[model samples]
Target chain A: MSSLIRVRPTKIELIRLKRRRELARKVYRILRERLTILVNEFMTRIRRAYHIRKEINRDILDVYNEAAYLLGLYGGSIYEYYDSTAVENSKVVIGFENIMGVKSYTAMMKKGKFINTYPELNEFRERSIMLISRIIELGRIEQSIKTLGVEINKTKRRVNALEYIFIPRLTSTIKYLQMKFEEREREEKARLKRVKSMLEKHRG
Target chain B: MGVRDAYFEDLVTRVLTRELRIVNRHLPYKRVSLCDLEKMDIPYIVLRDGTAHLIDPRELEYLTNLLGKDKCKLLLPIIIEARQSLGEGTYIVRDRVAKRVIAEILGVEYEEEKPLIIYRPHLYKIREVLPTTTTIIFSPT
Candidate 1:
């Protein structure tokens, strides 16, 4: 059975390895910084989505309870209260103000056809549900976006680890081996030259 | 036919041919008995079915042209056809085509059943007697 012997590395190989390692470290540092920024932004968006969703849900419940109470008092649908000219004239100022606020908020959220989409609920009730649904949708979008962000961050970390640790370590080991091999070759060449001169002198 | 009419007819023909290709390519995979599908990888399924099996959200126009104006009606049959081809095994599909196919296989009644936004990482636990009622359970493990 033959034994396996290790060869030493050459200087040229060591230089090449060191250059590669330095480049890899620089790339790793840049990617890590980018990943940190992306993760931070993603977390902020997730928090905003959560807060907005909670606010929308609370507002929906409030609107539903209030509408139910008003319906009970009026003895009919809320539309009847709004449609009657006399009632509308009496509460026009305050009622218009409330309606205007709802309309603007819904519009700001880009929700249209609030009443028709949810005809089962009264106008105010429908508006509240629509707003809540929009908020929920926004939350869902944020969650998906956050997940992608997380995946990107993980990938970046993996790349950085490979660049900084695995590649550099492997390169250094290769360089050391090459230098040892080259030194052995040079020494052997010098020994062969010396032996040739000694044999020439002996002949002389 | 006038030039415009001929152009329209050609367009229709090309679309019909593409749709036929999509259906035909998927046919072999669909025709595979449900019992034989669990052994193959996802890329194999895609290759066997054809590239059309992957639906990009951006490529809605192509899908629309292939399916026709009555998208709501045609959506289910196309999905069922594709799923039937994929055979009987669990699959993780994030693409729109896969979502549509799953919805059809399960017989989800709603036309606007949204694409699954979240999936349980462990898909093997899903069991359903009816194809349409399967609930994907997500286990972190």
Candidate 2:
């Protein structure tokens, strides 16, 4: 008679496989929730960035046009026509204390001196242009921040997908495989037990 | 293969075998060397020479088509030429049919190799090999 050969999976392995599946599912749920939040934050930031950029551009243009009109009164050569003597009278200003939200007064000071000396109606043109430049710089900073926010959100989403969707699916498949392995093992063990009993009976 | 490589391999197998149905719906697995193909569901094939790999199936088509019918007739020779130019280590073949077709036309030998892990940064690095001619298609899933 041919000897009976049996293959069986241990009980421990079956338990481990079940635990793995449960863990994978849990991870997937967590990632999905996190991803949704990140995506929402990203969209909100992008919208805010767009609105800020538009407002900055419009404000810069408005300031620039006003300066141009003022310069038009002084022969348009605001830089060349500046009053050199007024340098003594003009204070070296550091901040835009007078102008609300307009910073970088050093540039404004230079333009102010130039316009005062020129005696042209358009004398303030240079200062206006300088103010516009500052606004543009502020807009750039805002844009960079917005861009960074978008990138961070995208990265978060990617991580979430891997954690929730891809990893979970893989773990589930692995769990299935492990369970199948365990079932096969148990069947083999039963077969071996049956063969052993038969052999004992024969020997007795 | 490192974890990343294995992950990509598994991903490719799933894609090719239609296991990962949500991603890259157009890519399909064809009759190809199993070892070279690695994972069954993924949409890529492992290059014998290794080095860089292609992940975009559209890129493979664009490259093969650029080689023309005469060059594409057998497949292997073109793949060998591409591989020689590609240089070093295992690379995934994103477009199996195009790769095989090119290889067959070129009359080059093909062999199967075991799957291996691909690690991080390496996964991102492989993206460089994709053909610039084709638009990149990212699968969010």
Candidate 3:
């Protein structure tokens, strides 16, 4: 049986349960503070991500259109050549940067070379790279925000468990044991009085 | 924290600082000053917020070859307005190829005779493609 329903506690047990409750309270306080800060940081990250996405959507269309128009004017043959070479073996440099103590990836695309035949094509190719890099940066920020959001929720769950479930049950058990101990003490006192009186009456 | 604790903390968190200092190439963007831009020809001028494309004197002359000299403004650092001159979040581009490129991307109207007025979306495209070539200026609210 659980301690809440059927437990008889001696003074030692009561003291132990009281200590456990105190520790739970202390942990809850700390987690609650962390949760508040996490939520605020998450909000700021989401807002920045939202703006960046909007910027990307708004600008990306025109750039694509321009690329299409420019490519069409030149020839379709160039697209495949440029596409194969523009991003060959390119690695994105990813690292964590802490914003208000939460870490997020800061990404930068490292390109190989600008080895295209046509000068006009180079212009379009370079533009494509820039647009893609912006997308990468925005994606990293967004993913970090999501990670923080999940952590925040987990923290909240722990806080709730401590407050509503574990702490309350422990407290009730402690109260129940204290009441039982007082009742036992009173009973012992009455029995001692009765025994002493019987001895007095016999002596009379 | 104790001195020893602070020293260990430094060891754990030191990589983050190094990454920030070294690899922030395209994160916030590196800005270029106007004084430095005028001494020699450059493709772009960077403002605090966004990069702006520069109109070098030679490039302006090339623009003059196409649009004729009277339209060419013989000055560096042209101001691209958003609200008053163009629409909201726009920069008026003068080059024919660049204008056509922007127009094609944004699906916005353009005129061969007049300077093309670009909105936020189009400006975003230009900034993405030619980040160094263009700068962003917000309309006063």
Candidate 1 residue-pair clash tally? 15
Q: What DockQ would you assign to candidate 2?
A: 0.01
Report the poorest 10 consecutive residues by lDDT, candidate 1 chain A. Answer: A92-101
Deviation from native of the Cα of residue B44 in model 3, angstroms = 32
User: What lDDT tens digits, residue by residue, belong to model 3 across residues B1-141?
Assistant: 357744643442353233223221222234333334445433343333242323333433333454343343222233334333242234566755556545654677889889887655554444333322333332222
Q: Which residue pairs clash in candidate 3?
A: A62-B105, B44-B132, B51-B134, B51-B135, B52-B133, B52-B134, B52-B135, B53-B133, B53-B134
Candidate 1 structure quality by residue, lDDT tens digits, A2-88: 121122245654554455455444434434433443454455556657777777777777776777766776667655634442211
Clashes of each: 15, 46, 9
Per-model TM-score versus the true fold: 0.37, 0.35, 0.49
Error of 3 at A192 (Å): 3.0
Q: Compare candidates 1 and 3 on TM-score and give the better one.
A: 3
lDDT of 3 by residue, A27-101 (tens): 555455446546766776677788889888987987888778876887786677776765455567655543323
Candidate 2 per-residue lDDT, tens place, B1-141, comes to 357745664453444334212222222223233223223223332222221122323444444464554333322211211111222222334444434433444354444342222222232233223311111121212
Candidate 2 TM-score to native: 0.35
i-RMSD of model 1 (Å, 1 decimal)? 26.7
What CA root-mean-square deviation does each model show from the true structure? Answer: 22.7, 20.4, 18.1
Calculate DockQ per candidate and list them: 0.01, 0.01, 0.02
